[model samples]
Target: MTTIPSIIEELDQLRPVSDVAGKVLSLLDDSGCGMSDLADIIRHEPALTANLLKLANSAYFGLPGKIGDAKQAIVYLGMTQVVDLILLVSCADTFKGSHSGYGLDRGALWESAICAAILANALSEKKGFKSTGLTFTGALLRDIGKVVIDQHVKSAMPQIMERVETQHISFMAAERQVLGVDHAQVGAMVAKRWHFPPLLQCIIRYYHTPLQADGCFTEASIVHLADAICRKMKISPGVDDSSYEEDERIAHSLGLNETVINGVIGEFSEKMEHVRTLFLAG
Candidate 1:
């Protein structure tokens, strides 16, 4: 009996991202917003400020000396990267726990999400997409519906898996067949409730099937490809790992081929160690 209303009701009890994080996301569309505005807001959240400074000083960025404050971090990392880190730090706790519904243990989902976000950012840059940050955020939060639907999915795992085995459809399709809604759709609902931008909402909703997004096909496709690449790498995979499908047409449209895909994978593998240690460390 996990109806949409029930799931929507569960959102009220779910831990919310910080107000400061929400404000940063809201400012993304503002032409007047600047680095100082973001730095000021982040400075108020000591935990977020600490995490940002730690990440800035990590070997991943390779700055000359220590970054002492949020403003300096912003100056070094740039606004998009700073905002990406804010959202990542703000949402990390929500994704830290085990989600058995998707066969993800403690920290597994977070690792997978971080991998997807990085790959999506890389792909966006390769494709020369203007919304690299949007793609990064979209890939990171694409599976957020699982947070709300985990228990339901766990209870119905048997039936969902049966459909997956017999029908040879994606896990998302089986989710819809058994539960009347899939994670992507539910994720879109979460984004809407959180007042995320329309483009982001669309990317989360249609990432698995990017062609369905009217105006956001490219952004959604990038996330979709990134998720597929993550699963292919077996990086913290879930029960739905091999059950997901990729659209060759979408890849072709994005000018992605086996060579480009392999290059991204190699690049991701090289950076994986540093990123995991830096982002997941206490």
Candidate 2:
């Protein structure tokens, strides 16, 4: 049986997010951190620097000229967007492998992560949310616990799905009932291990049940909606996809309705294609 303690021990054996990425996440909570501070940290990692420039100069940004350096990329893309790109590059490798446990073949989870991030950003913009970066980051990593618990879920799928089909419960609930934990809880643990901000940790932990996040309810709600939207688009869905339960009241609280959500879905489809080419096609 895969117990929570064993799962936590396994996290120690798993590859940690890169030091550069850790610094960037830490800087997000630092109000004193400046553009130069971010640029300096990114410059130390050649691959991250290269990826950031490439993403900044991509047609997605529609820049008139090239972004020659990290600082310049920040100037054009803003601190929030630049941080998002760096985190994406830093964390991309972990999602590259096949996760058969979750029925995600090579790169499937990565595509899903990117799709969620983009959708979250777009949704935040529509709602005039000031913390688009936080929402984007939260949505991007919302399913990371799946990566941690994938093998366990795979081995126990029989029991988990039995409950899902017979009990008519959400997959996450089934996961908790059988495995003693769910992906969202495990994902929040991963975020804490990665030294992410407390708000972000709460967002991940309570995204499936945003009202539980207390002060961070709105942010969690945004990520929940984004994840729900991703599933609705049927973008690289895994076995646990269909059982997701969206909170309609939370949607109403965010001032979102079916019409508004459908509009966002249309926008997501267009952007997903463009981003697929720019970020994944390489």
Candidate 3:
């Protein structure tokens, strides 16, 4: 079996996160990372600052007036939003292309990622999770392995789909059986290479199999359910949407019944549409 370090080394050579985004992700677990701290770090990057301002000022924020500077934008946007933007800016270059590995067309992965992220954020709120920042970030980048392992997956898709069709297994499982590594595992290595927080790493690594996560089970489960919901809604980008089996037990484990789950999905769809509009408009 290929070691994790080897995968990380290969992925690092493929161009990792920007320095600015690395700094932002490092603060994912910090409790006292204030607005000024984030502002100080983000303001140095002109392109990041501009993009962050535009997003904050977009219909997403519904602010009364324009955000004048990075600090002001941080104030209005909150630390989590700023961090999410920074993460997006960091990975946008790599994730911008068509990730044919997962059968996603141009921009499809980003669309599904954002929608799952929005839904994860909503699920966190319903579960009364105070620090939903990492949850959202983890959800947003859940499929990053797809970008890293696109070609490998593309090459094996024929055999992979055959396995999926022949046996009652998930695309992820098929990927593991055929390719020896699934996107979740690759994504976890990618997250580790970037020094993502432990929970975030766990979520990225186990979003597809929340039951297998050793820790951060709730957040991982949230991402899993959110991803499944987005897949059902056709927002997810992949040829194996059927692989995301709907497990009511996942919701039950989170203390959420069917009604609550549906409500969260409904609200997530409405809010995600707005986020989609703003992001695509940019």
Tens digit of per-residue lDDT, candidate 1, span 159-180? 9999999988989999998888
lDDT (Cα, tens digit) per residue for candidate 2, span 163-233: 99999999999999988999999998888888889988998898889988877888889899988888888
Residues 118-211, candidate 3: write the lDDT tens digits: 7888888888885744788888889888887787777778888999989979888988888788889999888887788888899999887888
Against the true structure, candidate 1 reaches a TM-score of 0.96
Q: What value does the lDDT take at residue 217 in candidate 1?
A: 93
lDDT winner among the candidates?
Answer: 1
The stretch of ten residues in a row with the least summed lDDT in candidate 2 is 125-134
Misplaced by over 4 Å in model 2 are none
Clashes of 1: 0
TM-score of each: 0.96, 0.96, 0.92
Q: Show pairs that collide, candidate 2.
A: none
Angstrom error of the Cα, residue 62, model 3: value is: 0.7
Candidate 2's TM-score: 0.96
Q: Predictions ranked by lDDT, top down? A: 1, 2, 3
What stretches of model 1 exceed 4 Å from their correct place? 130-133
How well does candidate 3 score on lDDT at residue 118? 73
